[model samples]
Target: MLTDAQLLAAAARFGTPLYVYDAAELDAALARVRTAFTDTRLFYAMKANPNLTLLARMRAAGVGFECVSAGELARAVKVGAGGSDILVNGPAKSDEEYAEGARLGATFIVDRAEEVGLLPPRSRVLVRVNPALEVSTHDHLATGAGGSKFGVPLGGVPAVLNALRAAGHDGRGLHVHIGSAIRDATDFAAAFARLSELRPAVGELEVLDVGGGWSLDADLDGIADQARRAAQVFGAQLWAEPGRYLVAGAGVLLSQVVGLKATAHEFVLLDAGMTELIRPMLYGAVHPVLPLWPRSEAALHNTGTYDLAGPACESGDVLAREVPLPRPQRGDVLALLEAGAYGAAMSSNYLTRPRPAEVLWDGEWRVIRQRESVETIWAAET
Candidate 1:
């Protein structure tokens, strides 16, 4: 773990409300995935963090990408992600996006029957099935199983595949996304078994993609266990799309403490609010916070109990509740840990607040992105 002093030095140089990413950590993560699943291909899910600098770093590490939107696909293309290597996936894709991806020659993971009609002739396709497995994570992050709006239900997928086969669509694989931030390996195994039961022949399956939900802060050993199990079961080419597990802990969000307020409960207001990170207020997401000033007893100080709220006007915009942290004072720099995924990408300009800056650190810790100015925000509005 990098010391608070080291992070503070970087924050002081880069300015507050900045995202500092550790490129070495990301590379190490990719290496771990490669080492663990020798037969499996790891595609970094770009929806988690779309910073072009991060994308470029992942590209350099030889990791493929899973793009959700056409813009993300375009970014991947710009960063040298070949269409044949990149996997195009999303719950709801526009016809234009579908055409663009097919025209560009990318592999498309078909999530619905309607998507098949939009595909170009001779396009490669993979069937995305909504396994009836429940994702143990937060409700909002749960993407697989029957209730999710993300994929084609299990019963509907075979028929769609049959229809596509009858139409001569190039259906070459099976894709299943159980959930996001999933911690249980047993759950993953169960989901895989279900997908396997649906499609028996390993020879016919070109790729069996277990959707990207491997979480980092959770039981990575469990994830490895599950991956090993699936590798043994499915001899076909394996693929995984992991977002948070790759980048969550590798990045940090630095914000200035604007003020402190005490009502029925104490609150530490931060300059970077939900406009910068909505996971907290949006899904009751919890992130560890570190205070830069008045460092006293490390044990008593950072026992990690505080309500870190954002500056958004809505009371629901609170970042974390009952979070543990060292005592923070006004103007103090607060480093939010495990903010690499869903941190800056989900930022908005709600309440007219200026979005924060982003920077990437390649072990040496240099600024890769600059802070946004008030003039820049106003210029867009005007």
Candidate 2:
């Protein structure tokens, strides 16, 4: 694991409010999966981290890209991700996006029966089977559960297949993504078994997409094993769309401590708030937090269970609530761990707080994304 000092040095040289990604770690993650599941097509879900550098790296590693929107598809293309090698998903794609995806020669996962007509003749398409399988995770992150605006429900599958047969849609694959940040491999195993059961209905199934959601904070070896099991069960060209698992633990948010306040309660205020890293407040997400430099060398403190917040004026704007870590003082660097995914990408200019830069670490450091300045924010403002 890279030390916080290295990250802080990169931030100090490049400037604070940064999304620093470890390129080596990313390669290691891909290598782990490739080595474990030799026969599986590891699709890097671009929705998690669409940085061209990450995309290009994954592409160079001989992995495919999974996209949900036109912008994501365009980003993959910009990074040499072949259109033919892309998988287009998402339930609410606009006609323009669908046409663009078809024009680019990308494969799409049809989420609705009506959209089957939108695909071109001989179009490479997959049927997204919504098992309505509920997993133990945040509700907002659960997509396959019944009542969510995700893939076609299980009961609707036969109708979809019938529709495909009627419309002459050449469906060549099955796609299922149950949830995000999934900690249990059994959820995936169950979903894979269900897809396997439906294989007979989906003729000549050339692809079986076990969509992304592999959790990074937990033991991922279990995830690897489950992926292998899925490949074995499906017995088709297998695909795993992993987003956070690929980069969550490999990246960190480097924010400088600005002030400490003990008003109604003690708080370690940081310059990075919901504007920079919104996972904590937005989804009530928990990212292991720590100070760059421990306040004492003798022993670690109880972390005081204080809120680590930002300078944003909004009362709801906070990074972590009641997080326990070494009490941080003014000007100390606070490293929010496990923020590689959905951190900087979800950033905003709310409260007019300018976002930070991004850097990539590969033994040596390089500036990947430049920090945003107040002037940069105003440049687009009317």
Candidate 3:
């Protein structure tokens, strides 16, 4: 947990529009997961936050990694994760990625039958099964339901398994990722029960990868209980790939209030925008926003509804709407909570604005990533 002083100091030291991650919070998250899902293989889904420092910390904590690309796999290895400790998963994998995964001995979570042919013979693999069951979550985050572009449909699982067997790949397990930000335990239990039903069709499974999507607000005990049930029913090793659940609440994005706009609705314009944190614009997501420091009790209590707008030119660049906060003046710093996952990882050079710096604070603050400069942004331009 970062204090106002630490956040304020980070803003002062690194300038506004900075990402601050607390390593202690990350460790605590891992501890919570381990405590809840004891003995279950925990893989840190690198897509959520691929900061090298964070990867290193996770690796050191004896956590495996789930990578979606060769680059992510390489990052996992660079951070000290063994080849056997990584699982490669994605809807579309290139020949190069297959080659890399094969060379590194990383398990492949085959989403399509064609991907099975791309892997090395007798390679370790998990067939991603789309149970067509929808979890209670944002539609965009749902992956296992029918009409989804992600995993193999339920009806097609047997064919895909036969394809893997024919290809001589060791189809060790079944993987189900219904959706992300899943808060319901019944969803997990249902997904597992559904996958367990396929046991006869697949025959003698060795692993049940109840894929990542657990939300920070989800019932950990309920999820673990369901996972235990799945493991017992399938008589296989249980595994999970947790991304946002492990990191979303461990970070904060700091931005300085640049000015107040008097529009049809009052707006508090901040230096940070979609370029720094785009979840709000991307998913209509709401992140708790609060002033880092208040002048007095009155300043804290003098609240008004305002639209937290970003510096981005697009009208959709607003961070939050109808936000009730103390009257903010110019230079007031604001903190966006639950920004650890996908904050910096999903940021881009949109509008030619450089991505903000990222700092990791365990005990001492260290700049894990320097703020991108204009030259860095255009360095690849021919």
lDDT (Cα atoms) of all candidates against the true structure: 0.78, 0.78, 0.87
The worst-scoring run of ten residues by lDDT in candidate 3 lies at 113-122
Candidate 1: worst 10 consecutive residues by lDDT?
A: 197-206
- Compared with the true structure, what per-residue lDDT tens digits does model 1 show for residues 1-382? 5578878887788777888787777777777777666667878899899888888888887788888898988989888997667888887888777788877788888888987777778778888988887767888877886787878887777777776677778787788888777776677878877776765533356677886687675555566567556645655577888788788888888889898888887788888778888888877777887777766677464554567777777888787788666767788888888898998888877776667777766667665666666677789563
* Residue 146 in candidate 3, Cα distance off native in Å: 1.0
Look at candidate 1 and tell me the lDDT of residue 368: 61
168-198 in candidate 3: lDDT tens per residue? Answer: 8887878888888877878888888887787
Work out the TM-score per prediction: 0.92, 0.92, 0.97
TM-score preference between candidates 1 and 3, better one: 3
Q: Which pairs of residues collide in candidate 3?
A: none
- Highest lDDT, which number? 3
lDDT of 2 by residue, 1-382 (tens): 5776787787678767788888778887777666655677778888787778777888888888888888888888888876668988888888877887878888888999888777776667878888878797888998888878888877677678677757776666678898898888788777777766664655445677778787765455665567556555646677778888888888888888887888887788887888888887777788888678656754364457788878888787778877766766677887888888888778888866777877888878877777777899899779
Instruction: For model 2, state the Cα shift of residue 106 in Å.
Output: 0.5
- Candidate 2 lands at a TM-score of 0.92
